[model samples]
Target: ADGARGLLAMRQAGARTIAQDEETCVVFGMPREAIELGAAEKVLPIEAIGIEALRMAGEPKEGIGSRGAA
Candidate 1:
């Protein structure tokens, strides 16, 4: 799978990777391959991926600004 290969390469190059869990993926092929290849640092539901990525990047969950702040 090209996607799996890319994810593997990224992981090997010191980039953190996330794979969509089978439960949430409409088609699990790519993510499954990445998971089996040990390329995914974190396997999560689709809804949680972006939040987790932001957390991993040390960015605030509130996003770039305080627009949502009251």
Candidate 2:
């Protein structure tokens, strides 16, 4: 559960977080714990997880979408 604890601590430190939803979880215990501890800002299905993670990482720092410099 160290990973979960670390994620919780990160969220407590004002970081954005996401967890897999119970329905999509193969093992719901870890995410359930994180949610109970207020670590996760949102829980989404696996299918949409990639999109959510990308959103959390924010728009690319320097890539195709990097301002009009491209």
The prediction achieving the highest lDDT against the true structure is: 1
Tell how far residue 59 is off in model 2, in angstroms: 5.7
Give each model a TM-score: 0.79, 0.72
Give lDDT tens digits, candidate 2, residues 4-51: 888899977667788899998999999988888778888899898889
Please report how far candidate 1 places residue 65 from its true position, in Å: 24
Q: Taking the candidates one at a time, how many backbone clashes does each contain?
A: 0, 0
- Model 2 ranges off by over 4 Å: 59-70
The residue pairs found clashing in candidate 1 are none
Could you tell me the lDDT of residue 67 within candidate 2? 61
Worst 10 residues of 1 by lDDT: 60-69
> Model 1 misses residue 28 by how many Å?
0.5
